[model samples]
Target: MSVEGKAKEAAGYVKEELYEHGKPPESQKKAQEGRDLRNEGRVEDGKPPKTTKPGTSH
Candidate 1:
């Protein structure tokens, strides 16, 4: 297999390991939570969640 193929397979294995034994990283979890809240039209402390345009740095 090519190097790229091996890297992809390794990444899949790591994902499966994490799914079986560990939580996803906190930052990713938080980001998904924020997205879910936004989709639900939730406001925290009277302020809507801040959003950023894709491909733009904060």
Candidate 2:
């Protein structure tokens, strides 16, 4: 993943860690944005976007 995408994902993780009682919607949104950016980068490199797992949503 690109550096900005990685940083966003890491920030989301840290937010989740700091608010363990309940996950905030903003954190989830940030992580999803990271995933989207990573997929966009992959497509720019002529690769398919990463597939989500069978039981997961992305």
Candidate 3:
């Protein structure tokens, strides 16, 4: 199967697994918050916040 097809199948499997073995609401909320934070540049590569030197730009 193509990469997209495989990804879709994997997503379905994960959804079903989470439904069956879901975490507690608070933990799930915290997890989702972390996801949002990462999306908003709170963390990088599972590490702490990134730092940049003054007068430097990327």
Candidate 4:
């Protein structure tokens, strides 16, 4: 994944960990943004997007 994407993912992960009892909407949004960015980067690199089970981390 691209550095930016990885960074966003890490931020999201931190947020999730910090709020383990309940994930804020922003956290989920950040995570989705990270995944989308990573997928875009993969496409630009001429590779397929990585797949994961729904509701699971990449």
Q: Which model scores highest in lDDT?
A: 4
lDDT computed for candidate 4: 0.57
Q: Which residue runs of candidate 1 sit more than 4 Å off their true CA positions? A: 21-58
Better of 1 and 3 by lDDT: 1
RMSD of each: 16.0, 5.7, 12.7, 4.8
Instruction: Flag clash pairs in model 4.
Output: none
Model 2, 1-58: lDDT tens per residue?
Answer: 4666555445544553444333777756655665565566566555587667422545
TM of each candidate vs. truth: 0.34, 0.53, 0.33, 0.53
Which digits, one per residue and each the tens of the lDDT, describe model 3 over residues 1-58? 2454444444533443344334778655554444344333433233344244312442
For residue 18, give model 4's deviation from the true position in Å. 9.9
Q: For candidate 1, what is the total of clashing residue pairs?
A: 0
lDDT of 4 by residue, 5-28 (tens): 555445544554454444787766
Q: Which lDDT values do the candidates have, in the order given?
A: 0.43, 0.55, 0.41, 0.57
Span of ten consecutive residues with least summed lDDT in model 1:
38-47
Query: Of models 2 and 3, which has the larger TM-score?
Result: 2
Error of 4 at 27 (Å): 0.2
Ranking by TM-score: 4, 2, 1, 3
Question: Which candidate, 1 or 2, has the higher TM-score?
Answer: 2
